[model samples]
Target chain A: MKEIVVVSGKGGAGKSTITAGLSYFLKENDILVDADVDAPNLKILLEPELIREEDFYSGKQFKIEQDFCIMCGRCYQECSFEAIEIVNLNYVIDDVACEGCGLCQFLCPVNAISVSDKLTGKKYVSKTKYGFNMVHALLNPSEENSGKLVAEIKKIAKNLAKEQNSSTIIVDGPPGIGCSTISAISGSDILLLVAESTISGLHDMERLIELTKNFKVKRKGFINKFGLNHSIDEKLVNLFESKEIEIVGYLTYSQNIPQYLKKRVNLPEHIDGYKKLFEGLYNRLMEAVG
Target chain B: MNISIVSGKGGAGKTTFTILFAKYLVSKGKKVLINDLDVEEPNVNLFLNKKLDYDEVYIYIPEHIKENCISCKECAEKCLFNALVVAKDFWLVLPELCHSCKLCEYVCKYSAIKGSKRVIGKIGQSFDKMLHLLEGRLNIGESLTTALIKQVIGKSLKIKDNYDVIIMDSPPGTSCPVIQASKDADKIIVVAEDTPFGFSDFVVLSDMLKEIGKDYYLVINKYIDGEGYSEFASKNNVKVLGKIPYDINLAKNYSFGDVEDIDTIDFDNIYNTLLEG
Candidate 1:
């Protein structure tokens, strides 16, 4: 099976809109994965029906066994994250500050700290109305294991694709060039970035391109809101020319944005121009994967 | 006062609103320091007139000394980030994946694990008498985003007394990096729109802010009719701080990089709540 990851270095560039569109277009013979665990929006568009669910534990956390406390203060000095603190004359570990390092447990002279896996996020395998299987997740608030959760979701998507005998997998990625984006794009066959036509858009897209190149992945892109600024649009195309990233599509802003977004429109069924636009995007994708 | 502008979803105009708010403060004769903590892609400098260049910032990682190796796998097993690998004859440490938490050093009984510096990103600063801008740029393959963001915020706390107000432009999402940026802020302004994705993501961050008990306000950036976000804001007991109408010319000007002295969008409520109040 082939994998395609969609990412944008800048937030609010409409990466979810494009991913939803691609998922609707692919329909069958493909699996969709939402790698944007922090704030997944594809579920807003596709409306997937839950088929399977699982709790994801990436790292470990420590619990203080107060019954066997000595208050030696050695755990406090040995802690790397400063999670160990004495509150109200009682030793406790702040859940927010803990990195799940398990060092406090090992260094506890009284063995008062016990290490256990922490629940950071949840994963779901669902079926969309379009007859496509989807894998998505939601990282709990203030959770830091998003990179691991992303990798886990992608692994499930790959296994589901193999079981269903599908030939393609599309990933909706999180914005930024951090660990989560890297996990989404690391081994993907195709990278498609949807960049807006603004100054910040170009700047963030340059960073995205640099990140993709670091992973040795050739990225192709589409410019959202092309007519907003002709000069900047040309500069974007010129930058693509310089970087050797092909420009496969250009999408313009329309009045139906709010109207369409309100409906969570993923399919191009109602929009006239999008049918052709999605076809063009899919065609370029097919060509690249082939 | 240091206020951080954050959003759970991307393209919600965090950078746009931050720059506009900074400009408004400068016009009001308040010394401002704007720090862009979105090290993954620092783009606030794109709107500035001067060239943006950053000095390299490095983080500590453990480099294994083979002669002192006992191969007990203690360091490898106790690592918090799973960055170390132990083979029968060799050790592999992935520097890019390290969190620089230094847990490996504490676990080592011997002094085989040596602390070393690796370039993580670049931190840039530009200033005049009135407005100062500091930006963090993470190296392309670097994974230590929260560390660099913390460094920028940590340093900002030291020299913040020199400026009347400091505005932190945070990265997208409600994760570690965004939390790190918001933890130190006096107040947070979440930039969002009146859409489903925007509403849900805003609620996510709002819940987090409420849970953490941090002072925060909501700003609607691209409000068409304010149907979805307004409902969410009212339901959540959050005060609506400001609103920017969805206008094509404003977007065009932003695209063309011409956001100087243009008062197309009114930020009066925001100014009153954040500055005057």
Candidate 2:
């Protein structure tokens, strides 16, 4: 089995739109994984029927007992995260800022602080409307450690692929070259960078290419929304060529694209050229991965 | 006062709106300081044609002292982020995983660990008279986004007296970095594009803002004819700040890094509305 992960360092560059379209065209039995835990939108396109969900726990959070607490202020003084804040004359942990480092628990002289598992987010396994098993995660807003959730969902998708004898795993990765993007790229056979033909898109894609150098994964570039500017599109194509990345295909600009996406309609049926574009891109991807 | 421009969906014109609004404020005789908190990409500098003086930003991670090593695995065990690994034969440090919590240095009994500053990103600032720009740009492959944002914001606050308003262009998404940038903002403007994926992510951002008790207004970028943003706003009781119409020329100008004042948004009216109470 092979994993083909799609990432665009800049968001709203048609990563999910392309991924959903290609999933419909790929002939192989594939499992879909949405690695954008902070903003998972693959499910919005390929509506999923949830099979199971479970609480995902990672690290630890400290809870201070109000009765046993003496406001010694030691935890506040020692916490590097500044997570311990005084609220209504009571010391409370700001879960958003808390890094769960256990420094506060160790520094508390009153023994009022107790450590418990931090409920980070939820993991879901479902059957997508595209007839593929999907695994995705939703990290609570303002939560850290999104990379962990991405890795978790990818792992679950891999195991499910193994059980169901799937051939390919299509991952819709998050924006930015952050921890989550790194996690999504890990162990993937081919990293398909879905970039748009704009200056910012080109600049962000360059940063993402720098990131991919750390891994030995084969890279493919597909410029979405191409033809917006001939100069910018040429610049993007030159970038892909200079980086030795294979250019799979390009999708020209379309106003109807967003309209179709807004209505959650399948793109192949409504969008003018996306049907042929995705089919050719899917074939090229399978060829590259193999 | 600090007002941050953010959109959950990137490439949804957060940076474009920030540049245009900053120029608008300057035209109105408001000394504006623009803080580009989108460190991962930092596109504000692209549109602003100015030479900036840059200062390197660093984070201190535990540097192992190989000469003083007793190979006691205490420091590795104490590391919450698992950035350090010490065995009898070898020791390693993955700087990317290091959170810079200083726990490793604190736990080392034999002085086998020392704090060392590594350059993770840089802050660039330039004052063009009334319009001051401070931007944070993370080095490629670096993951410490929130740390750099915090430092850039700290520096911006120090020089806050020079400007009448500090407008922060926050990073996209409703994540840790976004939370850190929003922590100090007096008002937040969420730019939501009129698309399905855009609205989906916008709803997520709105939920996060509500959870954090931030007073935010929405601006529909690339506004279409029959979108649900207005209805969603009324249902959620969020104020509609202003909408930038969907113009292909605006997008074309953005692609070329040109910032010309367009009649698409009535910035003066929005400014008046923002000033109320």
lDDT of each: 0.83, 0.86
Pick out the ten consecutive residues of candidate 2 chain A with the lowest summed lDDT.
A21-30
Q: Candidate 1 regions off by >4 Å?
A: A214-218, B51-53, B260-268, B275-277
Task: Give candidate 2's error at residue A164 in angstroms.
Answer: 1.0
Model 2: docking quality category: medium
**Candidates' TM-scores?**
0.95, 0.97
lDDT of 2 by residue, B162-238 (tens): 88888999888898899998977888999988887788889999999989999798899888853778788888888
Error of 2 at A167 (Å): 0.9
lDDT (10s digit) by residue, model 1, range B80-123:
77789987768888886676677787778878788898888888
Tell me the deviation in Å of residue A39 in model 1.
1.1
Worst 10 residues of 2 chain B by lDDT: B222-231
Chain B TM-score of all predictions, in order?
Answer: 0.93, 0.96
